[model samples]
Target: MWIKASGRAAMLGLKKKILEQLRGAVEQAQREGALPPGSLPDVEVERPQNPGHGDLATSLPLRAARAFRVSPMAIAEAIASRLPALEELEPVTVAPPGFINFTLRTRWLQEQVHHILSQGEAYGDLELGAGQRVLVEFVSVNPTGPVHVGHVRGAVLGSTLARVLEAAGYRVTREYYVNDSGSQMEVFYRSVWIRYQQVLGRDVEMPPGGYMGTYVVDLAREIHGERGDHFLRLDETEAIREIGEVALERMVQAIREDLGLIGVDFHVWFRERDLYQDSAYQKAMSMIRNGGYVAEREGARWFVSTALGEDKDNVLVRSSGAPTYFASDIAYHYDKFLTRRFERAINIWGADHQGHVSRVKAAVVALGVDPRLLDVIIVQMVTLKRGGEVVRASKRTGELVTLRELVEEVGRDACRYFFSARSADAQMEFDLDLAKRESQENPVYYIQYAHARIAGILRNAREKGLQSEEGDVSLLNTGEEMDLIRKLVLLPELVETVSATLEPHHLAYYALEVATAFHWFYDHCRVIGEDPADQDLVRARLKLVEACRIVLARTLHLMGMTAPQRM
Candidate 1:
């Protein structure tokens, strides 16, 4: 059920209108002593899951029955009797036992076409976020190699979520956490050094457990091309660290370019080394220690997570006096919430980090920050297939189909649409053949075709001297026209829901649904009628068609995909 805040009353949709009416009715009942004068149950209005029930349903009666010492049906009758008559609602009634149901007026639904046209590209923008500051961190790949297709899910999900949040009125900051300090980074650097030596006419084997990627050799060749044998005169320590930094920069640059191909840009690139170099790591440990959650155990500093009901305590620093990556992560979040003062922070991690989620949440709680403010979205795996055959990847050996390759194979628009068309928690299959198809079987094609079809209609209408903005939208009373308007009116609600749930997959579903509704209306109705008698209808329907185009374009833009005017 949807709850309406007072400030958002003017923007309430049909469902929220019902919620407001129910709230007014409850207040009236309480004033007249029909119910107790105390805290009332929350007013929530929702679309009925089962279509036959009603357009909107409320469980206010069931919630209030126990509190008011009355049967559920009696409470519902009392509330229903006091409901004010409104033109926006039709056939307000009570269902069996407790639920209150209401259907929206068809005229109101048709009028929304004009509303959508008036708003244009801003039709679906919601005020749910109310400008709260939020930071979303994702695709913080190890930077040991090129960004692979394996990181695509979190990258797409996080970037789409950021866009949706911004649409919902949040001040969003997209961030990439650079893992520049750790054992993995050390191995990568040493591997690059060995590759550099091999390119210098020296037969050197790569160190055990170092990077075996072919890209490593490429990096070495690139360095040798720039600085021919100059590094050979330097000491081993200085050469390893300096050469590794150069290689790391190249890898990170490659990652950024690949992400740019898919329209992902970060507002901040936070380095992990900054945590220790800037004393932030010590401050975080100090805060946890003052919160009484830190203790020395087994020659190591532990977080004492067992006190929070965990079965085991996790070490923050090892016995050798080196801090773990977990410690750096705690410092990172501390910087996000306490230093930068972001109201909320979201981290999109791979499924392999599921165990780390609870540990991080515990750290947040122990650091005196509310754990609820931090959200960790775990993105599952993605399997790429071409003609039903699996495409395998191995980032360790650099034998991987990079994200750039995926974008190039299917085009940027198709790649973003397909990657974002599923939930992050759900494992997805990217089928290359279907994505390349230009028919209705491809969803991206189907949606883009609808937009293009509407564009063609509007173009023909203009050539016939019909002005879209000059049409009287009130003439859009046909069932198909009403259906398209209803679908257009749902974009705001979808934006609000996705923003609140931190789920952007709903946008993909809503885009397809909008495309389907527009196609249905276009199939049944003609916007350009040759007969002089139907000119008014043609003009009015052209305006409606233009509104559909606005919504479709806005939807695609939100998902970082293109809306083709001609296909």
Candidate 2:
């Protein structure tokens, strides 16, 4: 019952137990008058950097020393003496200058191998979110072209973050904010119209700053094949309008297909046009205007962002009476916060949108929402690599690399893994040759191979009529066995950490560590021993292997990658 309750507490079971003990000890010490107590600071626990120190450590005594007017070592002694016994932890230690260290019992770590097997796929599931609703909007490239390589990072990051949040017990909505209105859409419409004319053998020049990708030509050809010059007879205005609607639909579909190639999907495709419907845009503007953040200067509507500590004012609507992209963004967030009423809205934007973060948060504040509820993550650009050279353009299209092409080359698993291998703020280099490699040099292969190896071992045990369910896990006392169990138990903790920080890259690194640990255990230990006398050891090791498999599979799934059963 305690294990089940602890599993729901996000599997920081030992760490949490230590924290509880420490807090209780502090209270006991204060009541005993061994330590002067005003209100104690919040007790925090962390894993020590060096394994020799302990499994988990806390500097609560040091943090509370000044407030209590006592030396940290004195406080540590007082608390450590008062700490109640826990079966999962060995004797607690107090280090110099006041640090309380806890080492997990070896038998307790061994028992977790069985516990993890009981959890199976749900081993890492946590109650950290407690069912909070979160909306993660990402990879909202304009519906004017196919998704490019530059957009893949945020797509993978946002999708994986949504998954992690779900594992942490949060109800999450994945959305794509389609920029299907305003000047960009007008340009897109004009560009598609010119391309359609070219497809129809008409002599029409493309407007300045028009799309030049070969996909546009392909779109034009498809439209010609479908419509057969019917739009050619319409007046130029009507033709552009009709063709633009068709083009936008096709482009949005193309964008969906391209993103789907890398396993990115959205629950909602929120069009910018929707913001203007039912005077939603006007209502959003009115909220900001009433907050006294809107200003009229030189025939333009400006958001007085300087009033909210912004370095300069921003245009909400131009002198020409057209709203700026910033205005639509404000309306969009108003929908997310006020209309939809998400507890939190996380926007994953490209590096180019970094400067817009503060303004949007400022606008949220003016709209009577807490600025902290809006989190804007700026994902840096990605550079594709082959061998040692930078990959700039698609060889077939002679344009920037498309997300579809990247997926085709490296595959969906590698695309997700490599895109999420780095923090969102760091530019990543995706190596084509390495991603395709079948050897351990590739982390994707290495991690999957660990799962595959466990699968193979299980298959072998079944052929030999072995039953791991009856295994005595107490026999698993090897250093490598305990070490691997340590990694297996970290998944719930990882989910909680990533959910709080909104960073999914740590999952990649943790998967690799689990793989490395499994590899080491496999190298040093034999699962199915040849001698009949070693059957107990064989069964215990089989249980360990099975636990490792569940952990590896769960980790891979969270990263949006496949956990192959066979290499």
Candidate 3:
């Protein structure tokens, strides 16, 4: 049920209202002997795919038919006949195969414009989460280099989901897990040390599989400028350790700045090394071992994943006494679920990490936590294109395109919109030319232009001394007006749907639909006109346009995009 928490009682949206009515009508039918008394199935209400069919439809009768031992059509008719009259809806109708459809009255939708105006920025806010704690961990890219295009998709998804959850009344904590305790950081540290030697005029060959990006050399140069030959005085081991720590700090700072270019910020920057220092790793391993999920094999400790129905067992610690990345993940989740006690933890990882999902869940269960508390969203890679040709590397650095560069070229709004326009499971191609285009073909521009157009109308009204607050929403009776109002009232329900599904791409698509409806309404109606006698109609239309602006702006804000007042 799509319910929102109000002051003392739950505020029911249109979908929830329909569901309640359907359940009540079913009970009334059973009491009146129209249908057999039996257990009722879960009733669900959904928007009809065909607008002409009705606004919302349900299959409750079909679901209950077997239990009641009645024809679905007869059950539907019985339920429809017993339904109480709802002022917000037109007459309920029954369709073939036992579908009950409900359509909102045109006048009801028109009145919602005033309701939206009264709510203002609070129109779409929902309390569905009821103050539960949720940790959204994403973009935990190895702090080896700048944030590349491959990582930005997950970054945007995580940040947008965090925002949507917050608007739905969840206490959300955004986090980035810094993989500083792994072999990758070891390579990054050595790569920086070698680069420092090279910059100081030492002829040295880089290690096998060293970081070859120019950013590493730049890091070496910056270090040399600040502390010239300072590391040369220390022993090589000590010098490497110090240089690696400094390099890691610098890399993480760079990543933070790059993500900030697209409006992503994290409440927590968790270090993998902390798991060892704080004994979280030891605690997690102890719990797993006590649960008999750990075994000794091949001179190393192995996680007995096969016992948990996995195809193969996994090594927890190598023979050399070093923990694997999988071990680090188990410790991290222990901290998330047991130490911090978040009700739910959402991890957004790149597609490359898809294989680790089931194992992580298995590990969580080994630690005595419910596996359902963890959600892993794998975001596929992003392909950059320019003029329909694939763009592989940056022209300036000759490496993967950085998030900063993308934001600089296309602006932050375009970067966020395009990244969020696609589902996390699908690979998306971000077109540079289309993103920067000023025309309607660009969804970012088209949506923002609708808000800008509304702004212009309101500005014109104010200049003419026409007060929209005094307008009668009842005067809004045109088909276009009702259609626009219909779109406007969908925001609250959309918030609940996206919150429940944890899919933020729906918000992006909904924003576009709202923009399309506003554009259609504007083409057919005028909010500001020349004749004095048409002023009443003008005022009413202005109120509706203002409602459109509110909903559109709220949608953009939730997606972390700007609602430009002017093109």
Candidate 4:
């Protein structure tokens, strides 16, 4: 039997459908002159934590009540009465305190299996952005050393956010801002020079606060191997400048390679030196001065942040006549918003830089752009554990744990998944033992197992001459089946939520829910059996399993984790 469009309700997704129903109800009430006329606020719909309340609950009536100057319960009742009949929705109910709850129709729930299969990997994509340009700059670690685990969280967060935005229809640019020009770069250069002299068996005092890691020694050895005793012929000034430039490039390349170990690559490696060389810094400073946001005090150029509600002014240029990092950052952002013309700019910084957030936004506002268009995500530190004991630093490097070592230890999938398993704002402890384990206790294993198990089921079904394209979706009516279908349908809405809120950690939680739903469905519903009378049921369940695979795979891919067909 063919499923007709008239019989199968069109799914606009649960949240969107509920919002439409609420908005339509208000419009209908207005048409009938049953309530005061006014535009409704953006309806916020979410799944009720307690399922008994309803599938989705909203406080739109309470919000609208204020605008219309009426009792919330009365407005809710009027809105409920005026709701148009929707096949996907059973009915809208008014709860206490003006909450509107909506339940899903059984047929509509069952139809989602078809919808998921029809849409496949494209099912969860949303149109929330509608093609806005969003530039996400993250893990812009200074090119002084290798990328350590400290940088891992921000890299994962930014990459996942970029993926989420792309799924939500935003034109995204994954970027890395290279601090290639600064005092740190000079320090790194001198560090390398000192190591070069030491490596050549010369008496040289190591600079104070120089990089002392084994990697620095390795860099010196590399330079020695390439040009033995050649730097001794050059003057100190020439050697410092020439060798520093070479070491900076090498360090940046090393950082890039390390990031690649964990599946991070940037569309643009924006160099800080470019901002100065291109005079973007001069132009930005002039713009701020023209806007009266720049002032000179005590021979130092200061950003007058008090006008933007800051308690004190921040220095842009020091009295010694050298521009501070803050000055370069202002220019970089000016290029981001005005030069590059990105509608929105998102910077992912370490938690230590949280103080810079307000100041940068103040600078953006002073540069004549909306500060709201700039978003700063501060990712807290991550602590790693091995065998229930804290692993503060990598034993091999004798310093912070390099992201490469973490990936080599737990594999890229585990590293990416575990690093992104928590909110960027929250500090997390990564269990090295659990990550390396191949048990269901590990979440990556658990989620990947569902996909692998479904793969096995699909293979068995194929050998038995069963296919979802020929299956009858109506055969899926079990409670477990409906619950799984409902969970699968929530992915698109979840993407929308993450894109709006800039939180990809929600994907991690949602993936676990999907995995749980799949596991539950598998336990209660057997997909393949030899019984001739149950062939239709077997075919339908196979289709459902395939749909689950699509969602599971999409979620994993979105988080930069692999969806393994075999574990």
Candidate 5:
């Protein structure tokens, strides 16, 4: 009763009505003596895998043979007999072993097609994640070298996840944590300084642990152009500091551009140096010490992470007074939890960082924040293959491939789609030949082609003046068209599920299905026909095609792909 009266309750009422209808139908069958009074077991209704099975199938009788104390066939017949034959069901059948198969009203699914057309690209959006604030931090690649194909996956995945979260109604912040204070950055600094010395007529050998990438020479050239002869005369550390800042900024810019090619933007660029220099680290040290998480040994400070399940105690501050990376990270989390106050902070890291997970989560927990508030998503490593040969990348050995090179070779959409097409936990191989040669076969292009094809159809239809009519939706009965409409209707449910599970690959898969549906529908049905009788029907089909276009456009846009007007 309350369900019928309240607007919000109306949604629940529909479900209750379903349960009530199933139960009443069973009870009435008992009164008619069609079977024993309680012959049918509890009903279980779920959407069917194949559309021919109807909107939902219930196999309760099969699962409850012992409880019903009867054969499954008898229960299926009992339930079938008692229920009012739903008009939505084409021909409800009872399979052997008591499976109640339903065939949904194609008209209802067809009607949803218009809802999407009316809703435009916002069709699948829901309010499930409203008012929730989530922080997604990823691709905070150390400011050492340019991005590599290895770094591209995390950026694409993180950006895509942030977009998915937003569509599901959460206020999501996409962030990049700059690792400017790390040892790798120092090596990069030294590498550039050595190149700077060489540019200044000083014969200097490449430092043992220096960055050997071609970018080092480019950075030195860039430094030379701007600072002239004066910058070359300074001491190594001083000159490196001046030139390193410029080099780091250039590197960050190059990184930003690489991400921009794929449509990812960070809301914040939290500098790691800020944690150390801005008292955030000191404040965190004080809190952790008070909490008994920090212990001193031989004039050095250590965070007793071993007590918190780490393999060993990690040094917070060394005897020479330099703070370790772990110490700065502790303070970063402290500020993130105590100051930024994200409901949940999700950090996407490579598989190599799996060992760092528990310590970070523990630090958040140790700082009085809920342990569940911190989430670490470790995306597995990516293997790069060129002509079936794996490209071995190592920054220390300077065997790495920069991300800009990958983007330039394969393009951004293909790069993002390929990485996000599989579960992050699964190791992926980036095949250069496949990425570059057969661009049309790329999943991103396939989906984009759907949108572009639809746009072309719409263009052709409009040119023919095929003014769409809001005709009776019942006219839509084609199998492929119905399948496509059904897929569109379930998109909202898919979004909710994908958001909750954090398996963004589901969206990638859905993108492929949606495009496939469009392709099938487009091949079979023409949106514009010359026959007078086919005009209104053609117009109606136009509406459906528009709905598909909207979905395809948004889906590709979310994946950071362009919906080319003409592919």
Candidate 6:
């Protein structure tokens, strides 16, 4: 059941047979003593970054020259003569320093453009993931308040990464961890109480370190419920807990809505309160202590994290016998790895927790879990900018922007695109005005416009009674068309590389490359109203254009971006 040498139908539109031919030829050279046996390292083949250097380039000759005691130029000459032929990759010339550059045959590239049109939406997906299970946890903000813009970047990042992973053949679970413990929850309760009193028309000021947002005011009014007047005289602790519970639920609902607007939907909503109620942390602590991984110091229980590369011991329980936030994390991670047995667990955290990474890893290692099975991605800070001024994240009592507010201003698409457009390890600025623009200056709109244009062309082609069958592949031989073809053909490599690297930004960059190629082809090549002799060429060109559109559509889709058929 071997596949045929179909023109442009080569697997994934690559010259697979030709690559094998080249490999065989190089080996033949070694066998014939034209070059020393095993002189070259593994046939290192690659597409040159700069087109001027030719199609494919390899440094094998130079690498083996010193070992073989022969000049690199001579070694390259021997290999070139014995080299097997390839379809598009014409082994053109050996440059200085043992670089073998290549030139792709125009006919082969033209055929690729045709192949792309014929393939349509099926063009780029190569099924590389083969359906493995991958769980992604992100934007685990406490339910004390609405999600601030500070949390938006990671939300977009994790959701997009999940989409990318799914496209690459992994079944992805997107989860959000709700922190309902620690002093933060207490702060939340207090804020709700203050707001409840305010709603009841009390003259009391908010606590010294408490939220001043109008959201708290809304929560208080909801809780007051005609007892609005009685809330002012109610006991502080009772009022705080009541307000905290109801307010926490409302805030989580708002966050879900905010995420929903941006196309981010989570598979699980895990609460930290559930962990404590189930006694998971107590069991984890007891197991670690009995397992001899915990010790007592200064009347406090400390985990022996130093054995797993941590600098010092971390307190598992304070002298007051209450566990710290780290204790909850240990239990949560244990639940994920030990109880769930999810193959692996992935956490997308914010820059604020940068210091916790090492300790978390150490704890996982100490708990007898393979540290390699844990993946932690920290999203750097994002500064919201409007009118050339830095907008701060309102620290409960200060002026700031919530994620929902930002999404309302620009849009979900712009927010997701802007955040996931760069390396997650670096900080970025969210230009509010620029993202809201309808112009090409707005990248999401720019990419969407390209998709829309192609759709328009196709729709009108049908209405105008144009014969739109995929025309002859031989008609598309121009460099611009071939360039577009080559870029489209590399979709599999792009997806696989980005998935393996865990970098969704690479897919964003690929979208831009495909868009640039299509735009260039669109400007230079006409799609209709030509002479009869050029009729087939028009069809072929349109087909190529359609293929580009499909790729642009799907790549953006994988990124969870809307590829609009019209702006």
RMSD (Cα, Å) for all candidates, in order, is: 2.9, 2.0, 2.5, 3.2, 4.1, 3.1
Model 6 vs truth, CA RMSD:
3.1
Candidate 1 clashing pairs, residues 3+ apart or interchain: none
Tens-place lDDT per residue, model 3, 354-423, is 8888889899999999999899999998888999999977533438888888888999999899998898
Inter-residue clash pairs, candidate 2: none
Clashes of 4: 0
**1-567 per-residue lDDT for model 1 (tens digits):** 222232322235555666767888888888998877666678788778776676678999998887888788887988899888767677679887899987767766666676777777877777778889999999999999888888988898899999989988999999999999888898999999999999987998888888898888999999999988877888999988899899888988888988999999999989999998888899999999998889998999999887877778888999989889999999998889888999999999999998999889888888789999999999889898999999887655668888877878888888888889888889899898888776768899888899999989987876777776667777888778876876787778778888888889888888898899898998899888778888778778888888899989999999999888788
For each candidate, what TM-score against the reference? 0.93, 0.96, 0.95, 0.93, 0.88, 0.90
lDDT at 413 for candidate 6? 80
Tens digit of per-residue lDDT, candidate 2, span 1-567 = 657657653248667777888888888888989987688798899988888888888999899999999999999999999998888889989998799888888877887887788888888898788899999999999997888888889999999999999999999999999999999899889988999999888888888788888888888999999999989999999999999999999999989988888788999999999999857799999999999999999999999999999999999999999999999999998999999899999999999999999999999998899999989999997788899899877534428878878888888998889888899988888888898776767788888889999999999999999998788999998899888988887888899899999999999999999999999999999998899999999999999999899999999999889888788
> What are the clashing pairs of model 6?
394-400
Among the numbered candidates, top TM-score falls to 2
Clash count in backbone of candidate 2? 0
lDDT of 5 by residue, 447-477 (tens): 8788889999889988887766665566678
List runs of model 5 lying over 4 Å from the truth.
Answer: 1-52, 58-102, 394-399, 439-441
TM-score of 6: 0.90
Q: List the residue pairs that clash in candidate 5.
A: 54-102, 54-103, 147-403, 148-403
Error of 6 at 338 (Å): 1.8
Q: Give the per-residue Cα lDDT of candidate 1 at 176.
A: 98
For model 4, where is the 10-residue window of minimal lDDT? 1-10
Q: Backbone clashes per model, in order?
A: 0, 0, 0, 0, 4, 1
Candidate 2: C-alpha lDDT: 0.89
Pitting candidate 3 against candidate 4, the one with the higher lDDT is 3
Which residue ranges in model 3 land beyond 4 Å of their true spot?
Answer: 1-12, 66-69, 393-398
RMSD of 4: 3.2
